[model samples]
Target: MVVVKSVSRHADVASATSELHMESGQIIRYVAPMTLDCAEMNEHQQVVMLAQEKRLLFGDVSEEAEKWAGVSDLCQAMDHIVEIEKETELFKGKRILEVGFCTGLPSVYALEHGAVEATLVCTDNDALNNYIKPTIRKNNVGKLVNYITCDIEQLREKFETNKFDIILAPELVNTKPEYFEQMHDMLKLALAHNGMIFFSGRTHYNSCDGSMSAMLDLMKSKKCFDIMERSTFNNSVRNETAPRKVVQLMHKMC
Candidate 1:
């Protein structure tokens, strides 16, 4: 059993207790959603509520989400880690580079399991310093993580070539061709030969629109990455607003 200590900026914020049942026979204690109305909650409180809701729906299997409970897409994050672990031992002794705002769950999980080190790249310094850094320290993986606040284009200037064995990009893929092109260049520059990249996001705004197919086409034309594995799962059970299908794309640098 693990209890994630709540770290909130609001002094008057009330903490609600909840239990997350994991498949590994571990239970994590986390803050449940407050009874306050959404209109009354501040921005920070609302973000916390959304995270707690995700943890409840997803069962907090990794004990990573609740520690830094905020604006992370918990469903996709959990699915990405679970699918990767189900297939490979990629985390063992490997260096990880996590791009985009994933709430640092993947990086923390990597260090806890066996990864030598991890670098988390995000444009938000406030989120990195306030939420992610504290959570990393609480999880006792602070020394293994290096947080950087920079745009995706700055990655090449910040690190040497082939710096990461695995690159995690959750909720970074979109329907835009230019977006795909930018991400493809960044992945090729940072990822080592034979390294893997995980790109995951919702299939559409509200319904499946085959946007993933278009994105995959762009990826295939790059020639630098080979599609290794792809899978999709439904998010309708927990999220009724959009309830869209989510896709996970695993690519290996050739």
Candidate 2:
């Protein structure tokens, strides 16, 4: 026999009270929040109780789960950005451009961290206006962000040359080879003379045989940008063991 006590908040707890009799002779009480109905609360409680039993039957893997949770590409990118800010104050009062703004998290982070403004460019307007916009609004940085929906090739027509102080492309280099040419063009047209581009991607995806190397080669051949810093860190998310690399490139001086 197992005994588990579960507490839940509900708008009308008095009316939403329920009891569950498990096969293991466990009595689980569902305390509903003001927002949840009695039936919903009962169903929710069953899930919670089942999870608790599962952890009891099998050892809890919360620590292991947490260790991997912070190992995602997005998490790695955010950590790298934080490191850049600490070393260079890169986002302070800068005009930021974040390419591939799937979640728009980089732009939102920049605005909250001291960036004056950020322009988020992505091909998907639905995600920009729906998911990312709501989060920006919740962060109260809606006024500091501008959204642009277009492919990388259209960047020149969308903005004037030398418009951004820092261009962030988190995990942008892991794309198809054809996009690298367009990315190089965007860098030439959008980045200020002294501006920098900071991007990160998995090591395997950014090295030889990958599009990132090709992109860097293009920039170097053009004599338009110089690699400022490159570093790599290991990540073990989703069973992927490859190290992720972060690179910083600055516009070359004439």
Candidate 3:
């Protein structure tokens, strides 16, 4: 049997850094502050556990979307978000806009943990819409979250400039390489005074082609935000190809 400990509601920032461990045959489930000994659960059940971990809570999705996104990537992404939150004091009772929150697990986690409210944005899809709306209710965070299915840039009408206390994009930034600059501008507009932008992307240590270093250099030139903290983690899925993952917190300058 594998022993998995759940994070307590009273867990301080120091304790938020606890890592989830999975043995070859053991699965760990984090449903809010409760931890399940998943030894008796099967593969499908394990997927359910992972879905909950990926976002605050995952409602039912069509079998196709579930298989398309896969369990390992979703779980790994959530793990990175968890680590990012741990390293900074960004999420408690603050207004947040989580862009491209696939599975909505991180959104729910932020809301339940202390984020006053979260505006969740993702590409509009019938399957995801059906899954996330119910998931928000099922997780009992409906009052704490607003669901939006539109382009991030179009949020100009939905939210005012300097409105959100924190803006988060776990892995979505790198996926939309074409709109990287536009997305950065959207984040800048959505951020409140002294607000934070927490983002993650694949890093290239030596290559100058669109690496995190190049991105940071560009941001420095813009002089819009100050780099508050940064850390790297081993990519769980692309262990060999994309070994290092870069997560950073930027404070919007006054």
Candidate 4:
């Protein structure tokens, strides 16, 4: 099995406990979402792809997203992310939406790293935002960088189809897969012409599962969507993880 590095983390809520003192540089506590730490952070190095190498060398934040909660091994999945960034037209300077903005890792990284400009409407089910200290520290207490604490299905009213440059569905297999279809419909409404949508999952989530190929085909069948890029990475987090089997995909409205 390949090895991925272990990310450092603490279990007690960083700021909510009220007993812990925060560092001056460290943003105060964040309202972490109720996201499951699905897979352990793989500290081991697998293979670095082109963009992966660049991001790691540059210390890009999205590459570091997997580390905050010990959920992903960015090193193993670098190829997929890099390809999505490079090939997808959806990632640059456009209004973007994040479906599961749990740790704010990828979402903030996307903003900081050029995936989008202006503000991104990030949505999550985390209830910590009301008392979220980091947002205060970041001065997003209630404006600009927005976060919605509602489920994707419930917040359909917040977005208009074809109104955004991009819409992203992160690794949501652990949640309801039906949301993917809804995202597709919403992206059509939310994304501009020639805009893009990125959808991802670890694969085989339900009993009636769809492979990456099947999912892409399904998207095509529904509308004229073009696949800008498709790639796979490793999941060497544990003995049970499939070797070189993680999949990531990017799509555009054709």
Candidate with the greatest TM-score versus the true structure:
1
lDDT of 3 by residue, 138-234 (tens): 5678788776776655677676643888776655433334556766677777777767776654353222133455566667777877774343333
TM-score of each: 0.63, 0.61, 0.59, 0.53
Query: Residue 56: error of model 2 in Å?
Result: 32
On residues 75-104, what C-alpha lDDT tens digit does candidate 1 reach at each position? 234434555456436578889888743556
State residue 20's C-alpha deviation in candidate 2, in Å.
35
How many clashes does each candidate structure show, in the order listed? 0, 8, 4, 14
> Which residue pairs show backbone clashes in model 2?
9-33, 10-32, 10-33, 10-34, 11-33, 11-34, 11-35, 12-34
Weakest 10 consecutive residues, lDDT, candidate 2?
31-40
Compared with the true structure, what per-residue lDDT tens digits does model 4 show for residues 1-254? Answer: 22223333345443332211111111122333222232323443223223333343344524223322222322223323544444433345766565532444344434433554333344422334432335334533233255555555656666643255655545433344455576556655655675556555433322224334455556777764666543343333233221213333344423
Candidate 4 Cα outliers beyond 4 Å, as residue runs = 1-11, 16-92, 115-144, 149-157, 177-179, 206-214, 232-254
Q: Candidate 4: deviation at residue 97, Å? A: 0.8
Q: Against the true structure, candidate 3 has what lDDT?
A: 0.50
On lDDT, the leading prediction is 2
What ranking of all candidate models by TM-score puts the best one first? 1, 2, 3, 4
lDDT (tens digit, per residue) of candidate 2 on 1-254: 11234334333432343433322232223222112111222555656535543453344523222111212233234434465444437578999887732455566666755899988776765545444566566567878888787654466776674389888776665566677777777766888778887776543331223444566677778887788544433323222333445578887777
lDDT score of model 2? 0.54
**1 or 3, greater by lDDT:** 1
